[model samples]
Target chain A: MNNRDPENSPVIRLSDICFSYPGGPEVLDHLHLNVYPGERIGILAPNGSGKTTLFHIIMGLLFPQAGTIEIFGEPVRTEKDFRDVRKNIGLLFQDADDQLFSPTVLEDVAFGPLNMGKAKQEALAISRQTLSFLGLSGFEDRITFKLSGGEKKLVSLATVLAMSPRVLLLDEPLTGLDQDTQGKLVSILSEIDLTYMMISHDIDFLEATAEKIYTMKDGKIMVDEGLYIHRHKHAHMLGNMPHRHE
Target chain B: MLDEPFASGNSVIHRLDPRFRVMAAIVYSFVVAIVYRFPALGLALGASLTMIGLAGLAPGRVFYRLLLVNGFVALFWVILPLTAGGEIVYQLGPLDIQKRGIVLAAQITLKSNAILMALIALTATMSFATLGHAMNQLKFPEKLVYLLLLTYRYIFVIEQEYKKILRAIKIRGFSPGTSLHCYKTYAYVIGMLFVRASARAERVYQAMRCRGFAGKFYSLAEFDSSRRNYVFTALMTLTAAGILYLEYLPK
Candidate 1:
C-alpha cells in the first residue's frame, strides 16, 4: 500500500452517498464530503430534508442505498467494521427520550464505556467525571425519567461524552432547550476539540456553533455556507436569534 | 428485601472478583437443593446470611423481604406435611398436627433462606452490569445474557410508554364494570400490549444491528482480578464445598 499513515487521514469521508427509506424517493443522493479532525459542520434544513437519514447513514445505523462511508479511514458496512470506529464516534439521537433509555443518569453514562469493554469501576469513574464535566454530578443517582427535557439533552450528551469519542454527531442538540441551557450547550460543544457534525433547523444556533454549513434538499446537496444567514424566506421562522448573550 | 442497600462503599465482598461471586452462588445453590438434614441446611443458611450482613445490607430488612416471598413458597411446600400422617404433636378438633408438618416447614424455610441469602450477598455486593459480566464468566447462555442486555436497554423506553398509556387511560376515565364486553375489552388491551411489545422488540433489534452488535456483547465494566479476588474465590469455594459435603451425608 503506497501511502502515508492512514490514521492521520481525514476522520470521515462520504463518497457519492445516496439513500432512501424503502419505497421512498432518495433521501440522500450522490453526496460527497470529507471531514477533517476538529471540524464543526452543521447540516441545515427544514423538516424532511433527509438530514437524519443522512446521519443514520454516517453512523452506519442505516445502510445507504448506494455510496460508502468511511469513519477514521475505515470503511463501515458490516457491523464489525463499525464497532471499532463507533468507539471513537459518538452519536446523539434527535429525541433525547430515545437517546436516554437507561434507568438512571449513572447507568446511562456508563453504557458506552461498558460497551467499549471498560471495567465497572473504570466505567463508573468515566461516568462520574463526565457527569461532573457536564455539571450533573449530584444527579448521578437520579432516575432518568424524572429529568426535564433540558436535563435529558445534557445527560444524553454526557453519555456520549463519557465514551470519550473523537468524533461527535449531534442531531438537533438545541431543539427544546431553554435559552440559558442552549448557551451552556454551545459553550460545551465549543470547548470539545472533537470533529462535530450537527443537523438542525435553528439558524441562530447554526451560526453560534457551526464553523461551516451544508444544506440538503430533495435528496441532494443544495448549498454550502460558512457565514451568517442571508435573507431567506424561512430564515425568520427559526426562533433562535432571540437567544440572549447578556 | 425492599430496603436492602445495594453494595456501596469499599469492602472485600464488594471489591471481590465478579467471577468468584457468581460461581459461589451456583455451587451454593446446588448444595442447598440436595441438603435434607436440618443442621446442614441451617449451617449453610447461617454462613450465607453472615455474608449478606458483611455486604453492608441490613439483616432486618432482608428478613422482612424474605418474609414477603415466604407466602408464595409456603402455598406449594405446605401441601405434603399438612396432609401426610406422622407423629402427632397436637390436635385441633379433627385435624392432627404432626412432627412431619413442622419438619416440612423447616426444610422449605431453610432451603429458601439459604438460596435467597446467597442471592442477597451477590446482588447486594454487585451492580447489574457486574452481575452480567459474572454471568458471562460462568458460561451462561449468550441468548439469556443478551436478553438481559436488551431488557436493560429498553426498560426505560417501556416505562415511558407505560406512563403514556397510563395517562391516556386516566384522561379517558377508563373504568370497567363486570359485563360480557368488559372482559372482551380487557382481552383486547392485553393483545394490544403484546403487539406493541413485539413491535418494539423488532425496532430494538434493528437498532442493535445498526450499531454492529454481533453475537457477543461488549460491556464497559471490567473485572480486575487481584490477590483479593483469589482470596475471595478461595473463601467462597471452601464455604460452598463445606456446605456440599455436609448436605451430601445420609439423612
Candidate 2:
C-alpha cells in the first residue's frame, strides 16, 4: 500500500503556485506539492507562514494568482470546477467555533450529508453513526456553544467525518485541545484510513500520526525528515531533563 | 458565557411539542394584550402564573426576570400619574396625580407581565435550536429561521472575541475613565472587534461551503406528535375563551 510509488499519479498536485493578497506582498511564491492517495502528510510552519492559505487554495476558497491546480488528476480553475473538489475533501478549520455553525451537535454533523442531498432520515443516521464512532453517541441534542473545549473539538471533527470525504485538510487540529483529548484524536486519526494533509506546530503529534513531515518556509515546502528528534533523556542547564527537542 | 438557563427541565410544559407551544404563546400573548378589563387581565395573569408553575422553572430566576421587566414598568408608574391628563386623585405640593393615569399604568403592568411570563413558560422551555426548527415547521420564512439560528450560533463567539480584546488591553494596565483617551480607546476596541468578526465570518462561510452547504439549511429536528400536543391545544383554547368571556361579562 505504498502510495508514494512514482508510477501512481498524485491525488492532488499544485505546480508553480503563486498568490498574494491585494496590495500586499506575495504569501505563496512558486509553491509546489503533491499528495498521493492514502498518504498522511504533515506540514510544519511558523505563524503567518501561509499554511492556512495553502489549504484554502486547495479547496478553491482562495484562488492563486498563478498556478496549475489539479485534484484527482483534473485541472481546477473556477468555482464550478471546485464543487466536486469540495465535496470530496473534508477540511477541519483551526477554530472549531467557525466550523460548527449549527445550534446542536446532530444538526452540525448532519449538515454535510444533507447538503449532498441525503434524505432526512439517512442524514440523521450518518450523523449519529459518525458521532458514535468518535465516542460521542449521547451528545446528539447538546447545544454546540455549551460544549466544553474538548467536546467542541471532537464534535467539529465528527461534522467533517460525516461527509465521508476522500481527502482531509486539517489546519492546526490540536492547537488548543487538552492532553486527554489530544490522545483521543491521535488514536482516532490513526484508525481512520484516508489521505490527509495536516498542518500543525506540534512535532510530537505530527510524529505520532503522520508518515512524512515537511516544513514550510518562504512560501515553499522543504522536506525535513531529519528534524524528527528521537525521544531520549538529555541534560539541561539545571539538571538531567527528559524533554524532547523542539 | 450566555447559556440557556431554563431549557433543561422535565416538566409538562417542557415536554410539550415546541411547535404547538410557539403557536400557543403567540395566541395567548395576543389575547392578553387586547384585554383591558380587570377581570380578564386578572385571569390572564393567573393563567400565566399557572403555566409558570407547570413549567417548573426556578422561582428565583423567574422573579429575577420579572424584576428586570418591572424596573422599566416602575418608570411608567411614576410618570403617568403626574403627566397623563385625568381626574385629580392626589396633590403633593406642586404636583397632581390622576386616577386615569394610575389605571392605565396598572393595565400596562398586568398586560406586560402576563405576556412575558406566558412567553417564558411556553417557548423558553425549549432550547433555541428546537424553537428555530419549530419556526421552520410552522412555515416561518426560511431566511428568517436561518438568521435566528446563525445569530444564536455566532453570538457566543463574538462575545468571546470581545472578552479577549478587553483582556489584551487590561493586561497593559488600562482602566476605564471619562477622559477623551478612554473614549478613543473604546472606539478602537469596537472597530477591531468588527474587523475580526468579519474575518471570522468569511472563514465560517468558506468552511460551510467546504461542507457542501447550499442555500437550504436542512433541519434534523423533528416535532413529536403525541397526546400531549392535543391536550395543550385544548387547554390553551379553553383559557383563551374563558378570558374572552370575562372581558365582555359586564356588557
Candidate 3:
C-alpha cells in the first residue's frame, strides 16, 4: 500500500487497520487501502461487510484498534488532528437524512462553509453556488424533512460540495434512488474534478463514475476489475420446481 | 402528518416579523397569567380572539385548538368546584359546588385559553426556521435553538422508522394482546427503536463533524429589523402596556 515514496504521499493511506466492537469479532482485520490524488474508487460490499466501518475509521469517527492512517502525509490521532484532516475530506453518509440536519436546504449546505470560519454572506454565496452547480437553484428555502428522497440526496451532496473538500467519501449513495435520479447523480459526480471513494452496490453507477472498483468480504478487501455479474438459485417450498439466474 | 396549520396563511399578523410576534406573545401571556379579576381576564381573552381573527385562520381550526387546550382545563372544573371549601353554590350527589372553586376554575380556563390563543395567532404563523432565527437573534441559548431545529427536522424521520418497525412486526403475523408474550414483544420493539435511534444520533454527529461542526451552530438565515418590523414592535409594546395598565393599575 505504501509503494509510493514519502515525497509523493497518496491522498489517503491506511496500513494494518484492525477494528472491532467491544467484546465482538473483528469487523476490519488488517485491512489496507491507498487512494491517490484525483482517483475515483468504488468499494462494493454486502451489508455488514466493514465498508462503512472503514469509512468511519478514515473520517476519525471510529478509532482503529491498531492502524496507521495518513491524510496528505500527516498522521491523524487526536480530535484536533482529525479536525485538520476533515477540512480536506468530506464524507457523505449512507442516509441523507442523517447528513441534512438543518431545517432548510440552504442552511444545511451553508453549515460546512460557516464552520470553516467563512463570513455569513460568503458562506451563503458559496452555498448558493454549490446548489446551483448541482442544478438545485431555487431549493434554498425548501424544508429538509419535506424533500423527496432524490432531492434530499442531492441536497446532502450539496452540503458536502459546499465545503470544497479535495477528497470525498460517499457511503451507499445510490441505495434508494430511482434510475433517473441515479443517472443524474452519476453525471453530477463524473463532472466534479476531485478524488472520491464511493461504497455502493449499484454496479452500473459505479462503472460510469468510478475508475477503480474493490470488493470487501470477511474483513478483507480485494481489487475487482472484472464486470459485475451475480448468479442466484432458488428452490420452491412446494418442491415442484427450481429457479436459477445468472 | 406534521401540521403547520397557520404557517402558510397570508395576513397582516402572518407577515409580521417573528421576533415581534414572539415578544408580543410573551408579553400577552404574562398579562393573561397575572390577571385575576374576571373582567380583566375577559378583556385578555377578547384581545387574543381579536388577534386570532386578524390572522385569518380557519374558524374550525381555531375552535379545535381551543377545545384541545380547554379539555385539560375541564378536568379542573369537575374536581376543584366540588373539593374546594367555600360558600356552596350548588349541590350534587355527595358533593357541594363552592363559589370560590367556580371562580378559580374560571380564572384558570381564561388564562390558559387566552395565552394559547395569543400563541396561535402570533408565533404559529411563522415557519420553524424563522422562529429559530428569531430566537437566535433574541440571544436565546444556541444549544437549545439547535436542539429545537434538529428535533423538528428529525422527528418525522424517527416516526417513519418507528412505522417501518411496526410494519415489519405486523408482517410477521404478530398481533398485540394482553399477554406476557405480547408485552415482551412490545418492549423489545421499543428497545430496538431506541437502539436504532441512538445509532442514528451517532451517525448524525459524525456527519456534522465531517462538515467541521465545533459545538456551535452557524445559521445562514439573517433577520433584518426593517421599518415595518419596528412599527410592529412598537404597536405590540403599546398594546401590551395598555393591557398591563388595565389589568394592574387602579381604574
TM-score of each: 0.71, 0.92, 0.92
What is candidate 1's CAPRI-style docking category based on DockQ?
A: incorrect
Off by over 4 Å in 2: A1-7, A223-246, B248-250
Residue ranges of candidate 3 with Cα displaced over 4 Å: A1-8, A224-246, B249-251
Cα displacement (Å) at residue A100, model 3: 0.8
- Scored by DockQ, the top model is 2
Strongest candidate by lDDT = 2
Write model 1 residue lDDT over A1-246, tens digit each, in one string: 224355667888888988878898777879877787877888888789888877777766778878888887778887667778777878887667666655568877887777777888888999999999988989887767669999988998998888898888888888889999999898998888888999888888888888778787667765444433654544445457575335
Q: Write the per-residue lDDT of candidate 1 for residues B2-92, one digit (tens) a residue.
A: 1226656466678778777777777778878888787788788888878886776776877876888788778745565557669988777
Return whichever of 2 and 3 wins on DockQ.
Answer: 2
What DockQ values do the models have? 0.20, 0.81, 0.77
lDDT of 3 by residue, B130-236 (tens): 88988998888998898897788878988998999899999999999999999999998899989988888988999999999989876666666668778877776
**Cα lDDT for residue A158, model 3?**
95
- Count of residue pairs whose backbone atoms collide, per candidate: 11, 0, 0
When 1 and 2 are scored with TM-score, the better candidate is: 2
| Superposition error at A4 for model 3 (Å) | 8.8
In model 2, what is the error at residue A217, expressed in angstroms?
3.0
